[model samples]
Target: MHPTTTNEPPQTLLDLITDVLSLLLLSTITVQSFIGRWQVLRTKLTSLQSSLSSLSESPLWSQNPLLHTLLPSLLSTLQRLLALSRQCSSTSSLPGGKLLFQSDLDIASSSLSNHLHDLDLLLRSGVLHHSNAIILSHPGPGSDKEDLVFFIHDLFTRLQVGGVEFKRKALESLLQILNTDKKSASLVVKEGNIGYLTGLLDFNDQPLIREQAVSAVSILAASNDESRKIIFEEGGLGHLLRILETGSMPLKEKAAIAIEAITGDPDNGWAISAYGGVSVLIEACRCGSQATQTHAVGAIRNVAGVEDIKMALAEEGVVPVIIHLIVSGSSAAQEKAANTIAILASSGGYFRDLIIQEKGLQRLMHLIQDLSSSDTIEHVLRAISSLSVSDSTAQVLSSSTALIIHLGEFIKHGNMTLQKISASLLANLSISDRNKRAIASCMGSLVKLMESPKPVGLQEAGALALVSLLTARWNKKELVRDEKSLMKVVQMLDPKYELIDKKFPVMLVNALLSGRSSGCRKRLLDAGACQHLQKLAEMEVSGAKKALQRLSGISLKSMFSRTWRE
Candidate 1:
């Protein structure tokens, strides 16, 4: 009889048989993608070359006096694109060469987009929409900053007086300049440009013109504290909200970012919330594109830091949407969502319990372990520290070996915030025996953390984690033998410098002193901790005094005076 065959192959067997199909599909996709891009690139490059060659004769462009300011940038960008395309052609056959062609394609595409964007900005900025009278009135070029200001002001005055000629090309050009040059953005804001920028956002203004104006306003607002204060006082935040509520996706995105940046000032948070800004931001986070959602999440991050706004965000039912984005949003959006969650989770018990109830931690755990980005990890670590404040959540999170290992590894991270948060989380996990054992297994990492070079603020957290590991009792012998770790703990006892909170280090030494292996006490005495402890005793720190007396078997009454005893 023939043996019967099963319908499903074993997983390894199935995977082994897939190489032929996968390789063919990959080659087909790569070849098709490169071919399509190369054709498009060649077509665009040829057109640009033709345009540049005939620029001296082109009527709409070269023959027009008004096109003077736009020609140079367009010419330069075309030349650059032509050069890059040639480079791509040269690199197409070598090892890892497709990446170069692909990179060239991307750069050329974005450059074209930015150029087109500039053209559109000018067209929509009211420059081309109005009569030739203003076009002919254009001043050729300014000799200095003051002349530039006068040129811009003349256009603003024309707009203000509600008469005379085309949309404010002069003002439009200045805003576009400020958009690209940050230093000049500050200067424009300093020259009192807010009134005119806001005028561009007037209810009757074209959406496109208002859009670019909003962008310029946002750039200026980001320049400095004084600029933000100026924008905020000029009702700039309200105009931004109006655009966010009523404009195109591009305008909304810029407005959301501006609203978010402005709210970084502590004074504006409640005002934004009062404008129903939080509700709108939550909506954007729910349905906006990846880029929009990134900006929206950042806005939420800033607004939600205010207790009122954080609570309002929760009331709008955003947590579930945020959790969804954490699971499926683009990488940039995910990082922003992580920060928002971190802030919300720290708000209070209700937010923490809700996040746990929604399985937010599971998604956050995936982000932390999979992304391995330092910023994401730091934010997730902060979220975990906040969520773990609950004993119920602790019992669950404490079992993640991946998380514990990351925490231990982060102990030596370059970012002090991350190191301290890692230490704090490790300290929390030490409360559970399972986690305590996990931490004890990573004993060397903990010791290394204690020896961090920037020891300031590190000890407040590092000391607690040290105490947890050393207090495991089963692990004390190995921990005490680590002379670097032992000496670090000893060094923390010096009241001469406020290295860490005296309480944590004192508890650590007391824990170590109890049930000492003669080796442990000798480790302390040999590390010069006895002298540091004497200094603590004379300063009337009881924990240090008792630990010192136990170590040296000496009376303190005669050695230290009453004034020093407290």
Candidate 2:
């Protein structure tokens, strides 16, 4: 230092002191910045912990009264704090990011568990007020899933024990649960809760609760068979029956659906009829709602499957009611009513005449003319098939050229189902000599339809009808066995009517074996009917052996008679 001379300049004490003070100031600034950040983070964590702890202890945390006042504000604050923590974590790659996320999740889970515990306690203690308080607090769009589940379980449990007050609360809670999840609504039904809920059917004082209970029971009944039986056992049928008798329009409508579910069991068809359920269901068809009327008709259809059940309903004037539903209700109602009538008419000629006498024919004609409803058209065609071919129907069909013309058009343009029905109706029309002549006038068109590329079912029906007319004694001389008609039948037997080809040969053998008409048997035998039948017999098809037996009889008889003459 002493040797260092003029080349090196010496530092002044003030300069050194200034440098030291500047270093201390920088250090202090650094320390203060870190302290401020740490304090902010620590404050956040403390606030979160306090909120978590206070979630259970504070009176505002209680769901009874204070929660209604504090829940909205608390949720908002929680959301804001979570957002701030997320933002802070994103800005820095510090260890606090993971810690903050875990803390948030843990706090949320703990809070949910605490709320559930509180609801459980309220339920166990039978304090519906507090339970409802918990529910009300959790209201609004963004409620917690786990909390909702817990609340519903508690409410249901309380409903199992509590009386009217708890029932009211539970019913309200059930509405919320049903609105939340259909599966949850189904779960309550699965747990035998339907029995307890349906017990409220006796409560006339609270129509709202009664309505809700009925709605719940109906939902349960629709899901499965067991719940449906529970509804019947718990007087649900009786309540619905009474409602159908006395309830307002809306109640009657719901009751109709409920009754359908209950009576839909095929096993209960007779029981339903015995309990006057059929009459009630038929009466419900008179209501304004098309849905109600449709359901009512469907129930009647179910019950009508049983003979005694149908008779009971018929005695109660079900046919007239269904005819009214068909004519006056909506198209859908008309379709359902027609379907039920078809089922009723399928029983026999008695219902057929009844349907026609009750102006069901007019209703069916209306449906047939309605192009808007394909279902209605289909059912109308079915009704036509179901009509009896008694003398009265034959007379009407013969007199009404419009009806025959309409049926002819259907035979041409309708679906396979409608075509089959039309074919059957034509067969019925051809049963009488007068109607046969009426149908014979359309033989050209009938032959065309029989040869069309439509379903074999319709063609088969048409062919049989034509065969009957052609084979009739009075018309046989006038009938033309042209080559084209014969070839069409042959083609029907070869490929299109494989399953029913055996019946074709049988019919031919029968017609030939009749022996009442001279030259008919020789004509059929000459037309390869014998060879075709012998070929079928070798294939071992049913009725083939009978055909062979018949052929053997003819040969043996001819041989014996020839020997006797010799």
Candidate 3:
């Protein structure tokens, strides 16, 4: 569903980030008494978190009666433990915190003990249980905990009196309403009704009720922290897994959507995988309807972003299932499937080798040849980019004329990331002498990309590709043919290129000046490239000075002092 793109780590990633941040927090904690409570609670929280993480290994963890009884109670404590132990500036807790939030770590670290009693109350409040009444987020009149009690009392009375069909409509309507707003979604999930909601999925004859349950849980998981945290704690994912295994067709589709939403956070991704979502999603993509396949692929995409989870998927042999979708599934399914493969392949080394060994690149190239929608193009470009990083994969891609030409067009112009990635692939493909012309076809785009804004790494890549293109006699003439093009090549020598200390671009400058074409030489001079060259020649740089001597000689040096200074 790609409702949004994110690279921000979930709470699970905090252990790593905190380890890095802990060195920073060390002196701060030592100076004040803040170390006392923080050290104790942090250690306890660590133990609790380790316990929770183990549960993510399998649903069998849930079947242990001792664990099943203890987990629900411990979850609230863990939630409050995590929440209270946070550095005051926790970006995860604070809105807009990821980009610009710094916490008063001293104060937050010191205050951990004060929350023990409050946490006890919060946990005793039964924050994870499922019930019938709707819990409203509004703190207005008749909306407090007492108000909820009365509503629940009244709701059960009506449910007992209402007939079966009437009961189904009431549950469906509540789910519909809850799905409408974060407020309602938050209330339902935080109030622990997700367990009750998932229980409805077991009514074999009531698919609508089951579908609504899946849809509502999807909404709740997507809403905000309260719902996300509480629902996930209550084994909401295990419930969804059950639905995927046994529900009717429409119910399966909704369940798939809900599973994707739940696993979108990396914290939940491992839990679902432990429950065997990797195999189920693979089967769903293979056998479900097009929409079901699409959503299932989307779920796979999210779960696979967790590096270990992706490794598990590869281990389960679903890489072939995903590759199969690129050729045999609907366009939407292919797009998500391609994206899923792209992320896995991007994990590098073993992942790339696995895809290549699976003949994944061949299928992806086939996708490029046969499919041309914007979405499909984006995914295939990403996929090929990952695969092409390998020398062997690069060799396969170089042989595909369709891929080179299509990618050249994309490199020349597309979305920011698409153009940058396309240029990178071209750089790799250009390693093969046979593929330089294909990349050369996109010179106009490459020239512009060298001037692209910060973080592109495009200039280095574009220059490297140009160096390869210039290896062929005509390509040097082709690039130098336009005076603006000649200058753009010269401009790449600016020392600001952070990739490789700008050495590759300097080698490119050397390539341009040392070329055999008199026309290219004259055009280089005409475009004031000698000014850039003389500047480099005078510097202590190795490649630039050697390149100048190879291109022109002491006569140009004489001209440099006379003409360049003026």
Candidate 4:
């Protein structure tokens, strides 16, 4: 039976349990008229006695409100049974005859069985042992932790054994606790209450219950990977997808967020795709709320990392919706959309052409100028860099003076990651004479990066970009004039630096030698370039012997000897 709230003073659970036990002792009367019924009633009472005795032994029993609110009703029923038993024993003709009271005896017996069932469920649920452990860990007089544990377990009990109204109230309280206490939330996962929580997602008629259940589950999903794994193992994804399909806006948004977190793990990606969530997620991106669009796109972003899932996402027509988001969504949504496009575009030119067909590059260029957050810029830049790898797309990107300038700024002033990526992009963009001229202004900044002592990625990218530009005679003239930059390029060729790719600097020197200018050759000799080139030649490094051959016409030994004589 559900506990009733009343104006009357409440009895403590201990007092009520005691009254119930004593009432059971008093209920041992044998009726003269109904011999068989009396025996049956006695057998049920014995079972109730044993169950109640075991329940009272639980350390949390006295503190539990469900049992407290319930015991008084049991006492009332026992009182009626006792009075009826006394009546059957006392007078030959009673206030009510045996046949007249048959229904009443049956009612009493059925109510006792129901109460016994509720009690046995509470015991067998193992909540008592778990809650008791919580209490012992925080033993104190009315400590808040102790009280919270009691409330959490009671809510779990109600969720397990209580009626609809009881479960509803329990879910509300559970969400409230979950919102405020992170530790308690961890406790719920630890105690394996996720099944109970996810169970409520199927409450079709109860939208509020479903909302609250997903809300709690989303919290748990975001908590850690273990909680997410358990949620998927328990089949929460199907219910979440159903909510995305048919639930209210708020529920749909939450389901998307949970999906986002769940799919963050690469292993969980195929399960969502197998469940056919890809279409729902794309639909959410098209029409869901800003937050929903953000996280749904985020889920897509996570899953799109897998090779097969990447194709799956692209085939689902995610490209157009993602492009739409990049064009119109909020900053976070745009960032995620950009990242998803980047992942897809990194795979091949097929995705790049799709993005371009959707005018993704144009929209991404707009974001590069409009968005302000560094993280958002980083994601947008990453997408652009990946897309710009295609020669056709590189043509489109190089046409944007603003993008080339931004790449320069990012390489010169942005973080190391941005610098590396931007430099690589510049290397791609500088393949054309027109793009090389447009990118010539970034030459000094690239040289500055190459001068940095560590982080071979940035230095290597910088060298590649500068080397790509050095093919243009005017660009080579500018590099030769910057003697310090020229010396840095030569020093990078030393084998002791163990640079990732020595070919970029070697290529730069070869380009500088292309003109066969004596001044440039003399500068290379003064900067100790001859020794480094000779060593590289001995090692048979690509282009090293070629660079030395270019210098052969200058008579390297006599040139240095002539400079020393001067």
**Model 1: per-residue lDDT, tens digit, 1-566?**
11112232323222322332233223333343456765665555444434333443333332332343344444444545444444444535633576875776678667665555444443333333333334424334344676545445445433443222234454466565665455566556665447656767764546555655777777776678877888888888878877777777888787777777888888887887778777788888888767778877877777778877788888898899888887788887887888888988988999998899899988887777687567877788788889988887787777787787777667755377787888878777745555565556556555555555475756557767877767666667667777666776776777765635556667777777777556677777888888887777667775877787667766666444653465
- Number of clashes in every candidate structure? 0, 0, 2, 0
Ranking by lDDT: 4, 1, 3, 2
* TM-score list, all predictions: 0.66, 0.58, 0.65, 0.75
List, residue by residue over 1-566, the lDDT tens digit for candidate 3.
Answer: 01111232233333433343334334334332235645665554454344334434443332222222233333333333343334432424554452332244334333333233223322334322322323223234445665554333233222222335544554655664554434656545544445555666565676665666677676777677667676677778777777777766877787787777777777778886678777788788888877788888888988888866777888878788888888898888888889888888888788888888888888888777677677777788888887777777777777777776777777766766777777777666744455565467677667766675555476667666666667877666777776676666666655544333445556766666664667766776666566565666666566766656555555556656765678
Against the true structure, candidate 1 reaches a TM-score of 0.66
Q: What's the residue-level lDDT of 387 in candidate 1?
A: 91
Which prediction has the highest TM-score against the true structure? 4
Report the alpha-carbon TM-score of model 3 versus the true structure.
Answer: 0.65
Clashes of 4: 0
Better of 1 and 2 by TM-score: 1
lDDT (C-alpha) at residue 232 in model 1:
85
Q: Of models 3 and 4, which has the larger lDDT? A: 4
Error of 3 at 236 (Å): 1.0
Please say which candidate is ahead in TM-score: 1 or 3: 1
